[model samples]
Target: MSKNSSTATGTSVSSRILLDAVTKHYPGQSKPAVDGITLEIPAGKIVMLVGPSGCGKTTTLKMINRLIEPTEGRITLGDEDVTNIDGDQLRRRMGYVIQAGGLFPHMTVAANIAIVPKMLGWSKEKIKNRVDELLELVSLEPAMYRDRYPRELSGGQQQRVGVARALAADPPVLLMDEPFGAVDPITRQRLQDELLRIQEEVQKTIVFVTHDFDEAVKLGDWIVVFSEGAHIVQYDTPERILNEPASSFVEDFIGAGAGLKQLTLNRVRDVELAEAVTGSPGEMAQDVLARVKEAGDGHAVILDENRRPLSWPSRRQLSRLETIPATPDAAIPLVTQGSTLSDALDTMLVSSAGAALVTDRRRSFVGVITVEVVMEAITRSRKASAMANDNDSPVGTNTGTIEVQGGTT
Candidate 1:
């Protein structure tokens, strides 16, 4: 597995995928696991495949890399027909991730990430650099994690490393099958954010499989709704899928909270945040209290030297202390500007102040997002979507041409 001409420039050239009447029929089954389905996945975008349990979504994903050879039809990557290629060689050119990281316990973090690069016969220096670069890309510090074993890391850390490993060779396409399902809710959200940030930088063609519709909505630029036999019920953007359901099955899949799911489409940056009275550590508590009262704010946010939020305390708590403590309560619900309003609402619900603290990319506090702000955003979104619907305007962008045969939509 040497460096191919495609990667000689040290950048991934994301390639479009084409499935032409692809079908998979097992030996004993009466019906094919995946019926003849044709879909075109655009380059440099995240496409989610979602369906109910026992659907052939996972089988469809495996077919792309030849992990599960299609019994009929052709598969194409960019201009090349990969349907008949060697499975091992084809897989080396694509990144695949599964649940719980699928990491080898005996290997260290650096060793795990270097597996693909090493197989590609990269120089030792080049492999080291690539490992560190991917680690940073996934928000893990290479210096601190490179030497640690898989058992030494938290569940979230392991998942990050797994992603780093998948990206080790800088493949043009990535395949993920419920990659974040094993983690806790908070960690899963963080991972989703990290994936979005990384996708912005790398721009890989991603095909992800998930049973969770909310996760699909949050991450997918395009989504393919599948039925029992890998049938394409609908293929479109998240906005269109929510606003214009092709059929009753699609509507039921969306559920009753379609309006609430709209929050997942908008980011916190779209709405304005409320300003909070601010103070620095070592500042006179009385001065902060006076400012809080002057502004008629219930609480004041204490900042560190770098303008990062330290703690948020009320007027009564500020009065009891002579100066703000360098370290206050450690649990501050923080969200970045790119976070969705739904994420902010989750944060606010857990916070004692009923508001989530907004931060910049560097974790510096910017402002606060309250429940009122989210509600207003939701109202505005509904009104706008209704207008779009009434006018018969298209909802989402069509990145590539789609062809469906014997499917619902």
Candidate 2:
């Protein structure tokens, strides 16, 4: 059977998901798999549940959509109790994703993404439009991938399709359980970055479960750290969790260098980027070199007509050569304004350029990010973290339920 699209209308609506004293127990098990756990997942934000294996993290997540019913306590979607709701109906209101995409082996990618919309009786034209939108949302080109089966795609591509499927219905809430766990480390990191990018636009209340603290820190707006038996050790923002662990249990769980980890929260836009010499194709090599020398960076970034980055010209080509190469086609890495300092560092390292061109949403040139710039931002953030009060209240705990209102593509 093919997966179904979400039945939710394609609107940007979200509700604060609440788990009040949530507990789960097996028939023969003496102790509860998930002990008394009360946590508030704010609307339109990512809440990560992280801990060791068998820590009940996954069980807690499943309980939200009632995939695995809790033996005691109430789960609320906004102000409505989910425990008393119809299982099928409740699931239709939320999107669920698991490891390895969990796509139907027999279905094409478009079919998998359209399943929920079709089940909800969406018109063929509407479903088709949504399939294309979601594929683009997840960075999968719709025209290229819509007809492909799961077997034909790589693990990362399949995971993207799975994400596209989950978002097909535009559900207000999304539950992900180790969704990127099965991919290679590099692919996993890219997925994490992509997820953050998607969240910025969709703003669904996301509950993500992962064992990797790094992933948790990277993606979580707020994090709930679970100990043995699903007991909560700490529930707070990523910054608070990194800067101030609630207890020794939390401190131990978070491990060392918490401050360093906090750098991921700081974005490239937060720091001052250095001005770089820039030129367009067909510019005189002598002119470009003169500008580069004036800027004292000894390098020039060439831009296209749309102001998007093209390549970094070699200092040798500029300083000792003739007119700029007519077919300038060298590789230069790029980072967006929303890119975190950690992401910038990764780009620099991978590109071996020690610097990356930063751009805005319109793909226009913004500035450049270097390792030194990232380091400065981190140093400033660390000092701020040190002076910040650990007792300050966390973000997104404003109320039991947040009323989210916006438009959805």
Candidate 3:
């Protein structure tokens, strides 16, 4: 997502990790929580560990921190043996967020966020600066929320503050355990979007735990699917898992309607459409006739030099109305290059707009997304999904992670 990084998957050499013959055992159980798991995690990648409850997915992740020490095997962080490092020091260098926004009962949001920096011996001024910065990073106003106590905030706010706290020190290695799981579904989605945004800004090495396959697919650079006792069933990109489904277990986990789900993930650019309708407000009503004749479908997008939309004036607007009203805000959402065809459909549904005014990021209209375009995008997405499933293609780099200036790590 960073401008400097061509690979949006967030990979870098410094954050790579490796697990060699990793195994963990509980005191009373004869079976291991983790059983001989060997995995390679490229740096700056988010590898999601997902499965049903008590599947040992969480246990396998915790072993990276010695939270649950491995009874056998080596854990390496960028070629350094993490097993030899002190647990506290190792944890301090790793950003961690839990589902509940684990704030101290007695601390203000600012203080809660400052805990890690304070532990790492940051000056008071530095910690204050970071607290304010993180609040903004998480889309919260620092002045109104920083001094507030955890009890005074909503669950969503609490979660944001917790994320601010975890990211305070800008550690390269991040561990998240169902970090958005505690909030309501709507709030959880917002949090997920925010996480994706922040992850783009900060290209950290992330190992995340989740029970939800959708969440894993949405966030993972690569997903590591596990069975009971931390046995790996499959490890690959989200697209690959969905399309290829290494085994019946993985396919069954995705369930039906996967084609629809995959549609949301692919972008419009993945497919193409016919030239769209175009027109001008003041153009000779007769000119509309010639243009409509040329387009064959009987329409043309009216454009200003800037290409901001004016209207999709019906032939009725010209024939029935005395004058066409040109209002900028009245038009549908200005669809951008980054938006998926699915996004265009969503905007159309919400606005009841017959077409999307497709634009460049600069807001200059490039083309339009008409009913034809929408249908084409959907058809293309479904076809791609089917092909991907047939070939087991990897679902990597489906998103754009925009870097925020001055983002740490």
Best lDDT goes to which candidate? 1
Error of 1 at 96 (Å): 1.3
Clashing pairs in 3: 239-395, 243-389, 277-300, 277-301, 278-300, 278-301, 279-300, 279-301, 279-302
Q: lDDT tens digits, residues 1-409, model 1? A: 1110000111222488877778899999998898877777888889999999888999999999999999988888887899667788789899999998999999999999999999999999999999999988887888999999999999999999999999999898999999999998888888888888889899999999999999999999888888887887777778878887767888888888888999999998889999999999899999999999999999898888878988988889998999888995668888888788988888888775689888876668899999999999889888987787788554333223442334553
Order of models, best TM-score first: 1, 2, 3
lDDT of 3 by residue, 1-409 (tens): 2111112223565687777778788889989887777777777777898887998878877888788889988888876899899999998888888888989979999999998899999999999999999999888989999999999998999999988888899987888889888898656755765676677788788889999887787778787777777766666677766766656677777788676566546544555534666665566755665566666754556666566667666555556544434554454555555555555666666666666666654456676666676676568777876666486435322232411121111
Q: What lDDT is reached at residue 136 by model 3?
A: 91
Worst 10 residues of 2 by lDDT: 1-10
User: Which regions of candidate 2 are displaced past 4 Å?
Assistant: 1-14, 278-295, 302-307, 317-332, 362-364, 385-409
| Per-prediction TM-score | 0.89, 0.81, 0.71
Angstrom error at residue 113, model 3: 0.7
For 1-409, candidate 2 gives per-residue lDDT tens digits of 0010011212232477877777799999988898766666778888898988898999989999988999988888888899889998899889999999999999999999998898899999999999999998888889999999999999999999999898888898999999998998657766786788889888899999998887888888777777777766566667766765656677777788777777778777888887888888877888898888877786888888988787777678777767655464545677777767787888888888888888875557898888888777778877787667554765322122322111011
Residue-level error in angstroms, candidate 3, position 32: 0.7
Task: Indicate whether candidate 1 or candidate 3 has the larger lDDT.
Answer: 1
